[model samples]
Target: MRRDAWWVPQIGAFVVLSSFLAYATWAAFQNAHYEFGSYLSPFYSPLITGDSPHAWFRTRPWFVPAISPALLILPFPAGFRFTCYYYRGTYYKAFWADPPGCAVGEPRNSYLGEKSFPLILQNVHRYFMYAAVLFLGILALDAYRGYWFAGPDGVKHFGIGVGSLVLTINVCLLSGYTLGCHSLRHLVGGYLDRLSGRPLRRKAYDCVSCLNRGHMNWAWFSLFWVAFSDIYVRMCSMGIWHDVRIL
Candidate 1:
């Protein structure tokens, strides 16, 4: 039977996710502190200066050394998986609270089914898996960039600037999403002859399934939030808004 045709909620979600991603992509390229005279950077406030929360980025001629380029690369896999039919069948239906009328595109078959041209791009998940793993390592390095410098008082200080924090959380979220990948889950589960009397393999399968449950939501949320986090840091570095630290 054909899958139900629903389009409204799906379209709404697409719109919201698209808007957030569009603004964030532009923000990711900017300095951490961007400011306007009359108004602060949009959605940020308090105008922090000095070294209370973290050190600021020096306005440089070229790209800043500490910024993670994954800010740019991570979006590719996100866009891919968001449109994947597998996610539409499983995660989007449950967690996204997608209504019956919001099916932007209906699935034609199972994950192993045939693909035609653009639809075949779903296979690109394998390519994205490689990129996601490599970028995770890169983001870890970017997080460590905080440790490269110290405070003037000779204190062992690694500035957890807005950029640093965002990079850290972004990596964590990416890890969660990546772990949820069906390919990775299978890798962890292994291709065994049988599961009979195998406790460890069963345990691993259970763990992977847990992560897989929210895979789609995490994919989209992490993708969008990572970009937004970069924007928050960039605006801070540009001297446009304050990334206020409560602690």
Candidate 2:
């Protein structure tokens, strides 16, 4: 009775997620071409230690292994997404076929839900939400910095470029996703029983709820844009694509 190609969405999720994972892994291993002028890849934002002008530290320790700076930062966002409530159900259905489609039968008899090992690990999502919020601030700064470029005399001045807009849009999308996190919603207002008593908490919770309603949309769009942001910076750095300054 319910045979209307319900598996299409699951298959789409599998392919997009799998392909993004592969591309992100490959891009993270390439240490170079992650920066061009003032444009920095979201994957390598808050540049810890490197030769780039954006690096927080001037030098890398000789004892440290040669690895992409992205590895140091990617874990936080990756963890947040991996433990995401939406993603958990997505992969469970799409990849594991726990219930391939609506009205479909489960492969196993017992349903442990998040009570099981790997799924239980998602309990840490609240902690990752904290990290994700902090990252929003950092990425917002990166976007602001994107609007300023070095002048010919080696001085920085206000300017706008394709990269700047790219970074800005990425930050907006990321904010939508990170702010809408279920854990954050609970932290902000879930603890209280009466929102009418606390105006501040009520407002905060309302804002978060607005975005939470579209969590799945925010997640997918942000995922795609962040990857595209990295690609844009990398291409510009490699001279394969040009960063056209508008200001």
Candidate 3:
């Protein structure tokens, strides 16, 4: 009813996040040109089915030639985000208008916590964190591959390119978001009643706690950077732009 500063950010987040979801969904189904030279789009990382010996899986249903390889793997990361604690608060307000913001009137008078059919699924966030960690490892490997390139002389050389740095930054930001997850923090040492006696676990808990303090910031940063990394690689693969060599 009343205009406020919070509404501006809510609307902005809704627009940006919706646009990204649309683009990512479209890009995932294309299943073409996800890799260019040393750069690989984050959206298509861990390429399951492709024309490479290193491919771990290949889809050959013959019924769907246009089926994208990423279609099979995107659900893991998508699930993690969909049920993320930070994201729950985000979309709950932005999209669902669950009391949109402080002092704002809610559309529903009766609030049903995540106990019903669909919302009860939110309880699976911890399990999704496990898969998210695995994906971080896979993406980190992709970033490492970005630093290696073959020369015209049929020799491999280690070098850095603009795409390499972009992918590296994307992985780092994602790692921050994943490692800082509340579930991870609880896993680290939340069960221990006396953390004072365990030095190693205490240190680990402190580290994760530090990151958790900035969880929201990491969430948005990683979200945008991953999308940017994918776009950068896509453009390079299409020959629309060239990756600048840094080394």
Candidate 4:
């Protein structure tokens, strides 16, 4: 194990990142003013101030209007399992890498270094990558629903609430983060060896290569921001903070 006194920064990063993630997870479980039913019809608006029977609550059940808990926690383990630095022996050197702390006398076998289950979770990153991307589409749908016309004033409006902005920003951050992934970039654009002489191949490869260079930073930053987005909405719902509406 490479021993250096640089563990402070690693530990600090882990603590700050984990704290934000935990808060976001907590917020995701809280109920916000989500208009799941109104989204079914673009012309639906509950704040119309008339007895139009189009009130949103009639169609929307009060069940959890957010994602399943399993999907919420998926990012934590999935992120830890596939972190490029961890498998490459960075964890042992930086105590902060392993939140559980390093195990003494841990054998660093190149093949099965950390054994079965945890290692198996590493493969899940590929699958979760698809899931994360799909969630972006959902966010986009939510953003579209955020737009509405004020019935009382008969004025055109495209107002955004806390939840809608959160959803939109979450998707944007995730897209940037996902596109900057090293493994994903390789999977999508690294097949250039098979098309070496193709005119557009080299250009594609160059683009992915540039993204790959900043992949690590983007991955972590995006992971944190998405969680923060959910927290922002949750806080707004809890009356802890106001979710600013943008027109």
Candidate 5:
């Protein structure tokens, strides 16, 4: 019989998550404005096949449907977040209301405990973790690319732009979140019996632990920055905003 505002955060989470999904889904389908200058939307990074000069592959094959390149790549990163342990708890409470919060009443009494068909799929989270790590590298490269802009004479010059800062911060936040993952932390030292002999492993484990401590903060910040980074690039591409050079 708790009378506190326990349900407040759940409602907040629902609204924030729903909005992100709606915007992300719409942006992925647009296909245009995901790339501007050297800045690339994380959703379309490693742009496998598209019109952007940063595309990792040649133009889309003639036989393939004219879908957005993002549709082809978003799944990997999306799967990572979908199966993330923290996100699992967050969404389960906000979306499913499975005991929504401490002392909260759940809708059903039966518990499957992640052993059945749907919940069992969460076991693939570690694999998705691998993909997330790889994306961090790709995004970091994109951030680096954001710093250079083509001058009027067709020459690229190194300079700081708002997009560059946005991209750099996005990758940094993502890195903190990804690197501190429970899977990555386990990978670092979970198998070892002792840290006495492995100095490097111990050091790595300590680093991961530090980030994991603030995992929730990292998750929220990175999520917001990622969507914002895309908006910045998209607006610059559409001429709604200019990529101002800071330096």
Candidate 6:
């Protein structure tokens, strides 16, 4: 087969996404420095174990001291991303070589589609969306927490730091991606046979449709920012760098 421009992007996507997966896996297991001051890594937000402030609430019976809190929460978001409509198409072509691109030939002679065992699990994307929505709430709360810091005088004050801004932007981007999900759009208004009669639902559908148009952009933006937010918090927590105060 003749090579084309598509290969360039396909290769780039594979490299970048694979690198992220490796880093996330390593970070999740480390389970340290996920929270620094008010900044918390998105990967480990809503922490349920280890050094989490809420650890006294009764840790998971299966929780191990050596394991990272991120191990408990990363699955939901990971599942959502793995089965996302856009991501399915992306990794299929880039990583699986399931047609690679427009004219690229695939090695397999036949396709099983999503009816098979593992692929059939992709059908659970809608359910994952529900969990994803809940996670958005948790991340938003973390971002809110980022805005309050304690002073040397032991007085809590409303202030902003570079990490605070980073966490805030991460939540916003993640919200955009989660809200713009195809399953969410369908849930909002896709079932209606006559949207004209329901102005409210119609309006909601329109809003989601607008967001859906940029789903791919939101996907990449959220992916990078989430990792960046985690790295920023980790650096600050490790005392390798200091969070710059903005307010």
lDDT (CA) per prediction: 0.54, 0.91, 0.86, 0.49, 0.88, 0.88
Query: Of the pair 1 and 4, which is ahead by lDDT?
Result: 1
Candidate 1 regions with alpha-carbon error over 4 angstroms: 1-8, 24-114, 147-149, 153-156, 159-164, 190-193, 196-201, 244-247
Candidate 1 clash figure, as a count: 20
Q: How do the residues 46-141 of candidate 3 rate in per-residue lDDT, one tens digit apiece?
A: 776666533555655455345676787788888888899999988888899986887888888888878787799998999999999999999999
Colliding pairs, model 3: none
lDDT of 5 by residue, 1-247 (tens): 7899999989988998899889989999998889888899988887877556798657676665677878877888788888888888998999988868889888888888688988999999999999899999999999999998899998989999999999999999999999989999999996778988899999999999899989988988998999999999999999999888898
Tens digits of per-residue lDDT, candidate 2, 171-236, equal 999999999999999999977888998999999999999999999999999999999999999999
Better TM-score candidate (5, 6): 5
Q: Which runs in model 3 stand beyond 4 Å of their true positions?
A: 1-3, 57-66
The lDDT-based order of candidates, best leading, equals 2, 5, 6, 3, 1, 4
Candidate 1 residue-wise lDDT at 117: 67
Per-structure clash totals for the candidates: 20, 0, 0, 0, 0, 0
* Candidate 6: C-alpha lDDT: 0.88
TM-score of each: 0.60, 0.96, 0.93, 0.62, 0.95, 0.93
Stretches > 4 Å off in candidate 2: 61-66
TM-score of 2: 0.96
In Å, residue 21's CA in model 4 sits off its true spot by 4.3
